[model samples]
Target chain A: MALLKIRNLTVRFATSTGSFTAVDGIDTEVDRGEVLAIVGESGSGKSVSMLAVMGLLPDTATITADEMSYDGHDLLHMTKAERRQLIGREITMIFQEPIASLNPSFTVGFQIEEVLRLNLGMSRRDAHARALELFRQVGIPLPEEKLTSYPHQMSGGQCQRVMIAMAIASKPRLLIADEPTTALDVTIQKQILDLLMDLQEEYGMALILITHDMGVVAETADRVVVQYQGKKMEEADVLSLFEAPKHPYTRALLSALPENATGDRLPTVSDFFGEAVR
Target chain B: MSVVLEGRNITQDYHIGGGLFGASKTVQALKGVSFSVEKGKTLAIVGESGSGKSTLARIIALIDAPSGGDLLIEGQPVNIALKRPDPVLRSKVQMVFQNPYGSLNPRQKIGSVLMEPLVINRPAIAAEERRALAEAMLVRVGLGPEHFNRFPHMFSGGQRQRIAIARALMLNPSLLVLDEPVSALDLSVQAQVLNLLADLQEEFGLTYVFVSHDLSVVRYIADDVMVISQGLAVEQGKREAVFANPTDAYTRQLFAATPVTDVEAIRARVAKRQAAREAAGAPR
Candidate 1:
């Protein structure tokens, strides 16, 4: 059975200009232990769609859907209190900016412990022990010492590991990582990605990896969803998407990558999709 | 081509956390870095974050001074450590930053932003000529003349970057130090900006010191490549040579980490799948 499902989901924000639909009606699904990547550029509504799934969208945004369910629970009909209980325990999210996501005033250990204590209802002593284990699992060096360091004291990579530790504190069945490695160095990016995959496999968790990087998608994703300007352009297995992209936008995006350049003028999306709209 | 810009033994050190006679730790941002760019050519400096590529760019662009180094522009020695760089050298070198949103003034119109550089660098030029020049630059960067009146916020990230590039070119600098100029844009938009840079370079005979974390972009734009790690230049040579066979361990690691789509392999696989479907008489 699919762990998460959305049908005809649409998101619109109320702006001063008027109501602008950011995400048009789109259907998506995530199966247990699957890695589903949503790839698109900024303003494509890829992030907004995922944010809606996690119930993280702003109050100004109106989300309507024919069906949106997670683990048989109707997300669209779920009350605020019920979602608050489900979010951290069963579903967790990590963001692009590691430092900003973390609390500066609190130690990394306290953050992880709080997640464990609140979500999993663990004892204070057990939570401390579990936090250390989580740090180790996320591949942070000197896990015990790192627990005491504040977010500012650690490097970008280490802080991201701390964020991961917190996210996986409850062993969430569904993990949503939005551009998790975008801010880190390439080497660190590989390490964090490897760690995420390892944890996902070990815990049998479904991962929704959101990013604009095709290279990253090729490396980590099992299935891919390509979004363009709030609409689903294509969806396929990772290999199939790369090998035979049906959508002109997806093909153009792949061709535009500098890595694919052959000492000639690059082919932009405008070449395939016509004049720029936005 | 002649050597347009050169740096020798560049090093930058920052003093951290010293108060009231407390011993402050000195962190070296750039350590004995050296490279030279040829006239009308692009020299790419590739590195991960905290690798001092940006520091090297700053020194080359005369934005910041290195603690110890000698900088030469067209074989003329310029002491960048001075509070203000020599006007002639400053005018000869310009920089474009990574963040288009922050680099451009939100309140200023695109026309004024483009004209500001011209007015400051060439005060004797007539106001009418400056306006014409700005409009021409806007059109040159792929934006229409109608966009001249728009504010920075009105333009998209890619368009704003074009304006930034246009502004940088107003002085007709011989060298442009672009520090991750297209890193903030979307992939397709990145290609557009990169193509614009190449076109501009050919048209204006401009040299470029391209600093980027992306090796693929470096391969596309750079004639020569330098790899920096922990404030040190690990490797430097022709772009093809460095990319084909990196001598430094760090450079090799960076290559291994960078992701590249195997287009040919994917194409072949796609063809094979198509053939199988054809043989099976699969419906579309």
Candidate 2:
């Protein structure tokens, strides 16, 4: 059975101008221990769809779906208490900017310990010990000292590691990482991707990687879903998607990569599909 | 060919953490980096974050003076640390930053953003002439003249970057120091901006000192390559030579770590699968 499933999901935000559909109808499912990648450019609704699944969208946004379930439980119809119980414990997510996601007023240790104590119902002493262990597991240097430091004291890569540790504190069955390494350097990006893959294998957890980099999708994804302008352009296994993209947009995207350049001028998506695609 | 910009043994050091209670320590951010860029060519500086590539770029852009070094622009020596850089020399070099959203002023109209450089540097030019040049530059960067009235927020990331490029070109600088200028845009948008840069370089005979960690982009746009690690220039050579045969261990490791999308391999595999199916007499 699938760990998480969504069908005909739609999200519309009430902007000052008018109601804008950020995410059109889309269907997605992630089986246990599988790695799925959602690929798209900005304003493509790739992040919006995952945000809808996590119930993290703003109140101004309206969500409608024919079916949204997790482990055979209805996510859309769940009560606030039920969602609070299931979200951090079973279905956790990490955002693109780790420092902004974390609280500035609290110490890193306190925030992570709070998650452990609230979600797993551990005591303060136990939560402290567990937070230390989580930090070590995430390969943070001087875990003890780092726990006391605030988010502002850490670098981008270290902050991201803390975010990952917090997301995996309860050993979630499904982990949604939205552009996890986009803000990081290339060398640090490689390390973080390797760490995520290692942890995924060790825990056997489903990972839904939301990213725009074709290189990232090529390296980490097992299945690929190409999104364009709030819609899915194509979906296939990683090999098939790269080898023979069915949609014009996917083909153009692949061709647009720097490595695939055949001439001085690159072939952009708009070049083939025109400005209407935007 | 004339050298547009040259740096000899450039170094930057920072003194931190020494107000009253603690002892200060000097950290070397850049150590004796030297290179030169010829007119109508590009030199790419590649390194990890905190590796001092950005520090070197700042020194080159005249935004920050190196603690120790000799900077030469078109065979003229300049030391901003000792004295203020001449306005003419400053106008000879301009910089384009990485984040277009942050680089552009949100409140200013696009027309004013482009004309501000002319307004400050070439005061003798009439207001109507400055407006004309700004509109022409907007069109040159692939943006329409009608976009001049719009604010930075009204433009998309790609369009904003185009506006930024237009602003950089307004000074008509001989050299452009682009610090990861296209890293924030999407792949397609990156391609468009890169092509525009190439076009402008060809049209105006511009020299570029491009700083970026993305090797693939460096390979595409740069004529020369310099690899920085731990405040030192580990390697410097022609782009083809550096990329094909990097002698430095750090450069080799960075190349190994960067992910390259292998579409040709996948295509070969698909072709092989089809051939096997055909040999087995499978129906189409």
Candidate 3:
């Protein structure tokens, strides 16, 4: 069964001037123990849709959809208290920029511990113990010593690992990692991706891996969704998506990437994402 | 110099005091770094963070001077460290920074940013002339004159980067120090920007000193590639030579780290790693 399903989900933000739809009608699903990717440019609304799913959108936002379900529950009509209860327990999210997302004032341990205590009803001592375990599980060095260190003291890669550790600490059924390794160096990016894959296998949790990197999608995703200008451009199995992308945007994205074997110039598509597709 | 820019045995160091109550501690940011780009070719300085790529670019762009070296611009020894930059020399080289979002002032329009460089460097030029030059520069960078009135935030990331490039080119610089020019843009947008750069280089006959972390992007645009690690130049050669036959272990490691987009190739890689680990752990 699918863990989360969205049908014709559209979202808009009410700015001072007026309201503009950030995410046009787009439908996607995440099945159990599978990885699904939503690939797009920066403002394509991939992140916005997922943020809506996690019930973390701003107060000036408006969401309208035909259907939205999470763990067989109607997500659109859920109360704020119920949505808060579901967050960090049944569904968790890890953001793109680790340093910006992580709280600077608190220690990494305290941050993860609060998630445990609030969501799982664990005591302070118990949460700390679990936080250390999570730190080690994510391959962070010297879990005990790092418990007292703030987010600023850690490297980008290390801070990302801490974010992952915190997200998975509560053992959520669905984990959404939004461009987790986008800013990291190539080697460090590889290490973090591998760690996430390994953890996914161990935990058997559904993953919604959002990224613009087709290389990462090839390595991790079973299913893929392509978005252009807040619309669903294409959706297909991973093999089909790479082998024969039906949409022009998908084909252009594939051709633009300079592989180890590609020649000097990368072929570019003009105004590729300016058009809307469904 | 036959080369437009050259650095001879460049080294930079910082001193930190009171290590172990009396000893002086030192940190070397650059160690014997040396390379240069010709008048109209691109040289890529590739490395991870703290690899001294930025430091090297700064030194060459005359933003900062080296501690121990001779910097020759057009065969003339420039003691930039000892004195303020020569106005003519300063106008000859420009740098395009990494963050297009942060590089421009939020309050100013695109026209003002481009005009600022002109007015500050060429104070004798009239305001109308500077504004016209700014508009022309916008057209040169693939942006229209209509864009001159827009703010930096009004443009897309890639467009903002183009504006950044246009601003750098306004002075008609001989060399452009591009520090991660397209790193912040999307893949397709990155391709478009890179192609625009190649076209601009050929048309303007401009020398490019490109600093980037992505090796693939470097390979796509650079005529030559220099690999840096921990503030040291590890390898330098023609791009094809370096990519075809990487001699250094670090270069090979970096090549291996770049993820292959092919699914079968990645699976084969993961399988190979698993087999190697299994073979190593096998007991008699």
| Clashing pairs in model 2, backbone N/Cα/C closer than 3 A | none
* Selected candidate, larger DockQ, 1 vs 3: 3
Task: Write model 3 residue lDDT over B1-284, tens digit each, in one string.
Answer: 25888888888786779767888888898998988778899999999988889988998889887888888887778888688886788888899999999999989999999999888889999999999999998988888989888888898999999999998888888889999999999998899798889889988988999999898788788899999998889999999999999999988989888876786774564466456446656321
Candidate 2 stretches with Cα past 4 Å from truth are: A274-278, B263-284
Q: Interface RMSD of the predictions, in order shown? A: 3.1, 2.8, 2.5
lDDT of each: 0.89, 0.90, 0.87
Minimum summed lDDT over a 10-residue window in model 3 chain B is located at B275-284
Candidate 3 wrongly placed segments (more than 4 Å): A260-265, A271-278, B16-25, B266-284
Q: How displaced is residue B241 in candidate 1, in Å?
A: 0.2
**Residue B20 in model 3: shift from native, Å?**
15
Order of candidate numbers by TM-score, starting with the best: 1, 2, 3
Q: What is the TM-score of chain B alone in each candidate?
A: 0.91, 0.92, 0.90
Candidate 1 per-residue lDDT, tens place, B126-226, comes to: 99999999999889999988998989999899999999999998888999999999888999999999999999999999999999998888989999999
Query: Where's the lowest-lDDT run of ten residues in candidate 1 chain B?
Result: B265-274
CAPRI docking class of candidate 1? acceptable
Instruction: Write the number of the candidate with greater lDDT, choosing between 1 and 3.
Output: 1
Q: What are the per-model DockQ values?
A: 0.44, 0.43, 0.47
Best by TM-score: 1
Per-residue alpha-carbon lDDT of model 2 for B1-284, expressed as tens digits?
99989999999999999988999999999989999989999999999999999999999888898999899999999888888877798789999999998999889999999999888889999999999999999889999889989999998999999998899999899999999999999988898888899999999999999999899899989999999998999999999899899999999999988887786654554466457547756443
